[model samples]
Target chain A: MKKSLLFLVVTVFILSMVLSACGSGNTNGSNEGKANETATNQPNADKPKDKVTINLVAFAQPHEQKMYTQLIKKYQEKYPHVKVNYITTPPADYATKLQAMIAGGQTPDVFYASPENVSFMVDTDQLLDLTPYIEKSDIFNVDNVWQKGISKYTRDGKTYALPKDVGPFAYVYNKSLFEKAGIPTPDPKKPLTWDEYISIAKKLTLDDKGNNPESPDFNPKKIKQYGAGFWWHEPAVWGNGADYINEDGTKVTIDDPKFIESLQFVADLRNKHHVVPSSEDESSMGGYTRWLNGTVAMFPMGPWDTAAFWDLKFDYDLMPWPSNNGTWGTWLGSQGFGVSAKTKNPQEAFDLAAFLSVDPDIQREAMTMGLQVPNLIDMAKNDYLNMTDKKPVSKQVFLDVIETNGHDWAFEKTYDREWYDLFNSSVTQVWDGKKTPEAFVKELQPKMQELVDKSIEKKKKAQAQK
Target chain B: MQLTEKKKEMWIAYLFILPLLLQFALFTVGPMIFSGIMSFTDWNIVQKASFVGFDNYKNLFQDEKFWKSLYNTVYYMIGIPVGLILAMLLAIGLNRPIKGSKAFRVIFYMPAVCSLAAVAILWQWLLNKDYGLINYALSWFGIEGPSWLGNETWIKAGLIIMMVWKGVGASSIFYLAGLQNVPKSLYEAAEIDGAGKFGMFRHITFPLLTPMTFFLVITGLIGGFQLFVEVVIMASNGGDGPNNSAVTLVVYMFQKAFNYYEMGYASAMAWVLGIIMFIITFIQFKFQDKWVHE
Candidate 1:
């Protein structure tokens, strides 16, 4: 009798263990069904009576986390029946983490996404179409926000996400370094031409012995200071009116002569003119460090850098990028707040996304904290530009680029960036002076085009499967 | 009916191993089988898998980057032999009846226990072209060192140097243990036969150490081929290095799986790697009788 009792106990224990393992999934499914019933029965209710809990996932800095926490507190108070759980991940791992959650069937109600991820997310049906939500939203009118920010997420007639912020990459010069060199501070309204910019860079660059680049006795190897430290090739390419891809993203156009010339000019900044740090020098002490130490005269800055730059020992201000033909250009970065397709409460999810993205009060608070440029055009011009106590005295430069000059980088427009990554990895030879830009571009264009073609095929397959 | 003694003992043993068996089946065998099936499909993790009928394998065979990464992985294996030889020498040196030998052994073993991520970061700063300690020392001899991590030709050599520094200690410890097991009677017999120290090491000591050498070689080759973390953290441009020179096979697989979302292709590459490793290990075991004393 005791032996039989022991065997039965053992079997019961093992069975319970297995059952409990499967029980969690069942509970989740039931809860989801409950949420759906509540959502469908009261589709038009302004405030849900039943308790609704939503999850918001995003990558955030410490200050941004605090801002969101405060915003959520306010939101919960407004709708007492709603409870929100804000989950954060490091920015570098955010995409993979979010995708893993979706694959595991535990997608967040609202999440953050980048412009580069929009097409892929939409193709995989991971993003909820926000068109109907936006069309009916009183606060989220299309005319109120920057079209460039909104249009990045729009495809065909549907929008997948709403713009969280628009960040413009602008030129920032160290006031101390320029003043010590006896050069006039760059004019906020007027941009320098390429030739003028190069001349200024030459004057600003000095060896350890204080001899400028143009001086006969100057030595390139023992340079104590660099003039300009622009590392990205996007500005040079776009300012020269040459792009990596054609419109509609069908062809790779990096083989264009104009593109080759712009790329070679960037290389010449180090190899020929000896104005900027060489690749080797930059690796040892990065350009950012050099700028912080007052060795580099000018470097690119974005709106997200405003808070960090405030604590600098030296004064710095923004200016328009050097122009190629009376037009300056740089890359604009935008991250969006998106609703997950699997959310049971689309209305609640869209409301949270809309509040975080387009709420002017929250936007103003974020802007005041130097977290981002305002998404609302009126607020950006009237409020953000009027904050004179903020450094980067020429705040108008950020607006100028956002309003006209900035563009989505070529890689952001593509379904996948493998082709661009290939280009970037192979072009080091050109940057290192081992190959001519023209030869390198011509040789690599075919390989890049092949990858782009493969990406197109993959995209088509995904769409067909959907 | 009452249970018999044998049946009771067997039941107890089975109950004790049940948890382990369940864990192994769920975590290891389940994923292994799923990934094997995934290699033959076009699954991107988020989407439903579609059967592609060996297309992933076919495409992997033609991929130039795959070949380059495989070549890079094999090139890094050159460090294994070089590391083993140095380790053997260090072990012999530490085995001598010399003062501070205990301190020296502890010092050598320190790198093996250090966190790999931290070690990779340290090496990154040490291999910097203009300001690195290595280059700074090279400058004293009036020889300008090439950029170790930045230059395409030198990145692998730089990585190999770090790998050897981090790995040589653990192997030496293993060799030290093996050295203790060498029978003293054999050395005494060699001395009686009028053999000198070198002669004894060549004939007796070296032959007896063959089993240990064989073990280290087999394990070293396997570990060297999966080199990922150090290369990813040490090399510039998100681990691809300049001109894709430092991309090892595992790093490429990781890139495809995570960065590019080509999980099916990554799985196919992983299976190919596994088969190659199995074949190489099997060959090693088959040929072991010729050299291993045991």
Candidate 2:
């Protein structure tokens, strides 16, 4: 009886200890809340510029990492008093890792922000408002940078980040493949219509028996080469004068007939036309390698692919994406740097962000490395267009899309992208010939709309909490 | 009381275990209680939490994705039984006094020790629809192998195959040890009672191995329920698979908590999973007496 009593007492004591531990956790959470209140109350705690070490976090490829290392050396040379620490992780883990850091209260002073997460960051107060900083700084000119890049991270007249690079997509065709097929190369300035594009693709696609998809004896099972590889459906939808959302962002318009038509056309290329590779075939030899080996005649190119494409064995050049409505559309992507709202050394962090973002010398070096199209409009039009030492001789195609028709990706407007992700996963059925594009879009509209509505509601709640 | 020798020894034993007790109370018990409380509130880690009171749980019931994930998780448990049977057969086979049996054991055990990420990648190549070795072999029999990873209907089965292949080695080792524990006298007695090899295995060997089988089943079910890394590495798009067919409960919970920051909902999911696991294990333990021999 005494031993059991002792055990009960010990159990009670341990239970009390557990309760106290939870109580301490609550206290710690409230303490973090207090810290955030103070951080915002004193937005700029610019202590005497005595050697402050501010850290920046991003994800980059090896070459991009080397580029940043060189850029940091130059920046430190210019401002020797401020020390910058750059942290990089693999690209796939960057977003999750950055958010985890913020949650852990180890938020980096400066970090890369993509369009997809900028809204979420803003809703969470993770980003510092850059409008005041931009107005005070003379070196970082908003007028010089492309509006397409700058506008993505701006919300409610407040700029949260500055554009580091603006990636414009261009249609690149293998010149050797065209020559071997005894076909004339496409004009750089003009885009082919959907009908013309399909006919040309049929001619370019070849079987082991040397018959094109257009021939009676053509065998898709033994196809030696594919004509085109188009992974993204957004471009085709936009080119056909339809969009994922309406202009006011009040409604999802993906169920529009134009969107279904465009989707069907892309799907039919693989399922019906036998020009584009099927999902199974694409997996066997990835689209990137297929393009590299000259098995695929045409594929989309981004500014980021420039450096890698330079070493291709066969000749290649850029053309406009095929248009259904006399205007081509593709995504213009941007990655930017933002100062953390909780950062103590706001001034130094902002300076580092600006130097990395809009500095002419840095942008020029990045352009030389084929890392990006210049964030500066004038430089992209003149300097980037004149760099004829690259394989993609028609550089104007990239500029034309950035300057004219490229739209921000669909998910950029929302705080979260569950809606877009759901749509992408579900739409595979349409692409695989299991369902018609029209039926799939009709069935998916309400579901996608519901998720979008939920995200918007979440954003409103976040704003109200703030 | 202090003068009592037994009481003094008990106090010393308590003192020795005090550090471990404190650690458990502080970390494990504390966090579990906190998450239980958190499940009742709406908390985005960065934002202030507000009490929602079972709203998250109610939402979970209506969520199609939750149901899909749960179904997928239970579907993956099919590998456990399949793995156990294969492992038992392998253990029995390797128990023979044959040339290179030890080498064969090592060869089979290789997959269990290999890194999951590397193994998943190798399986991806082997399961590829067009150029895979599996499909190439099927072609010899004039049969076309279905797209294993690509089609929604086949993806779960594909994952089950990979999981079974990876798990059989470790399970067989446990069964092998259990087989050694079975007295050779029992088999000899069965044989003397006019039993053939199959009869001896059925009556003596299989019945004797029930305890090990029970232990393996419980652990395997628990492990199978938490399937995440293999699915993440194997599935093409961040573990969603074709039409989210490969998304298990734990993966969905992870996506909710980390990717979407729905901590309260994810906490509710974790609790539901915990409850399910507890119920299953409790039932298994309660029924073990029916099949398990002393």
Candidate 3:
């Protein structure tokens, strides 16, 4: 009797375990159904009654979190019903983790979105379309947002995220280094041409002997610090107008003469002119350290360096990159917000996205906190350029671009990775003097064509489905 | 006839084994099969996987960067074995009934317990070209040091050197234990036969240490391939810096799946690596019988 009773209990326990395994899946399905039903029927629900938990993902880690949390706190205060939980990820693993979350249908209501991300999710029907929510919002400026960020974020006339910052280029110079070298600073009145800039770099070049400029017998080998940095970088390619992809986002122009010339120009600063360290030196000590230590005199960087230099206690001035070929150019980058399509409340998610981006206070706060250049054009012109309390470098870069010619930053989700890799590889050979510009271009054409062909086919398929 | 005593015994054995079998299937076997399947598809986090067949494998054939990674792994594998041998020799030297042998063993074994990840950070600075300990020493020799990890030619060698310094001690301890296991009678018998030191090592000590050598070699090879943490902490950048010299296959797999979000491609690369490893191990076992005695 005891053995029989024990067997019954054991069998029942095993049965329950098996049933529980199956039961969880059904429970999730029913829970999703209940949520969807609640969302559909809850138009008249009071503000504080429907508590929403939005996941906020950012590419920038602990650094961005410090400032972004303050922004989130302010938002929570405004809408007491909404609570945002910020999930910070390392820049290296951001895309992979975000992808997993989307696939698992544990998608964040709002996440760090740009043309580089979220679009792939959107195409896969994993991101919610924000068009209706964006239109409904009173504070959202549709035209200004589109004019600023549409190039990078739009797919078949639908905008995914609003612009967050201007990641445009600037030429930052050391006032102390120039003064110490007893060399005249480059003219702030007129943008230095390539020839003039080289002359300035030469003048600023000094041996440890206090011999300012080369005395014609200057020992390049014994030089204390090179006058300029000639590191292999992306801005050099952009300055010379090397387009990685065409308007259709399905072509490569890396081997173009202008691009090849730009790489050669930088490489020559080390190899030929001896004004900079060799490729080995460039590799060993990256440009940022050299620039910081005053070893490299005038360097090219983005507006983000303004905050970096501001805290360094060194006298510095930021200038727009000089015309390498009579074109005033800088690379602009746009970052914005994205919504998950897999969310039970697409409308609610879209509402959160609009509030995060379309809020002018949030945009200005992001700019002040050094997150990015303000996305609003009028605001950038009036407020960002004319802020008296902060440093003037931010104003100068934007004002120069606005007055000269507007450059919008780009972000492509799928196509840029292959194209960027091709450009970097092809130009590296030319920079090393292993391959001629003509050969490099010719070699790249077929490979670029194949990748672009694939991209276009994918885009066309996406268009047809839409 | 339907259920004999032996059959019933086997069934009872299976009943006892079922929990472990289920756990293994759930954790190990399931993931292994899924990973192999993932290798054949194109997966990112957001999208459903699509079958890419052999495109990833084909691309790896053309990837110069992948080849560089293979070079780095191979370089590490080559160095670790030679280093372990030298360390074993060092172990043999310390095993003598000389003064302070205990102290020497502990001193050498200290690095075995020291964190490779922690030491690599300091080693990175010491190996720095412009302001590093190695260059300062090289200056005395009238030889200017090349940028160790920053130079393409020296980067793999640099990583190999770092790994060897950290790993050799643990192998030395294993050899020391093996040395302990060598029966005293064998050495005494050699001495009675008037066999000198060289012959004593060759005939008795060396031949007897083969099993320990085999164990260390296997562990060394496997450990060498999966080395990622020290390299990551040392380089301070992804695998692309310094002419892609520091790139390794595991690092490549990691970046492809996690960084680039090409999980399917990474999974494909991972499976090919697994197959290569399995073949190499099988060959090692097949050929090992000739040299290794029961």
Task: Give me the candidate number with maximum TM-score.
Answer: 1
- Supply the global lDDT for candidate 2: 0.86
Q: Rank the candidates by TM-score, best first.
A: 1, 2, 3
Least accurate stretch of 10 residues (summed lDDT) in model 2 chain A? A40-49
Q: Write the per-residue lDDT of candidate 2 for residues A259-357, one digit (tens) a residue.
A: 999999889989999999887677666888889888899999998898899889999999999989889899988889989998878987898899889
Over B1-294, each residue of candidate 2 has an lDDT whose tens digit, in order, gives 666668857776885697688888768898889888889887777787789999989999998889999999999999999999999999999989999999989998999999998999998888888888988998999999878888888889888999999999999999999999999888788878899988888888999999999999999999988999889988766788878889999989988887776888899999999899999999999999999877
**Per-model RMSD to reference:** 3.3, 4.7, 4.7
Model 2 regions more than 4 Å off: A1-48, B1-27
Backbone clash pairs for candidate 2 read: none
Candidate 1, residues A1-466, lDDT tens digits: the string is 7568769867987787677767865776667767767865775667537667889999998988998899888888877767888999998788889878887888899999788888888998989999988989875677888988888888887988998898899899989888988889989888888888898899999998999989999999899999988467888888788999999887999999889988998999889989888877877888988888888999999998898889899989998888787778998889999999988779888888888888888999988888889999889888988999888889999998888889997877678888888888888898899999988998999988988888888788888978
TM-score of each: 0.93, 0.91, 0.85
**DockQ, all models:** 0.55, 0.41, 0.32
Candidate 2 - chain A - TM: 0.89
Which candidate number has the best DockQ?
Answer: 1
Off by over 4 Å in 1: A1-48, B1-21, B97-103
Question: Candidate 1 on B192-246: residue-level lDDT in tens?
Answer: 9999989988998778888889999999989977989999898876778888999
- Across residues B1-294, which tens digit of lDDT does each residue of candidate 3 receive? 555656656655665675567558767888789888888876664455667788878977887667877877777687767787788898898888999999988887777788776788778877888788888899999999988876666877777777777777778888889899999998899899999999998887787888888878777777777778777766534654454567678887886776455677788878878887787778877888777745
Q: What value does the lDDT take at residue B216 in candidate 3?
A: 80
Q: Where does candidate 3 stray beyond 4 Å?
A: A1-49, A142-146, A180-184, A187-190, A211-213, A230-233, A358-371, A392-394, A399-416, A425-466, B1-24, B43-45, B50-68, B93-120, B227-237, B258-262
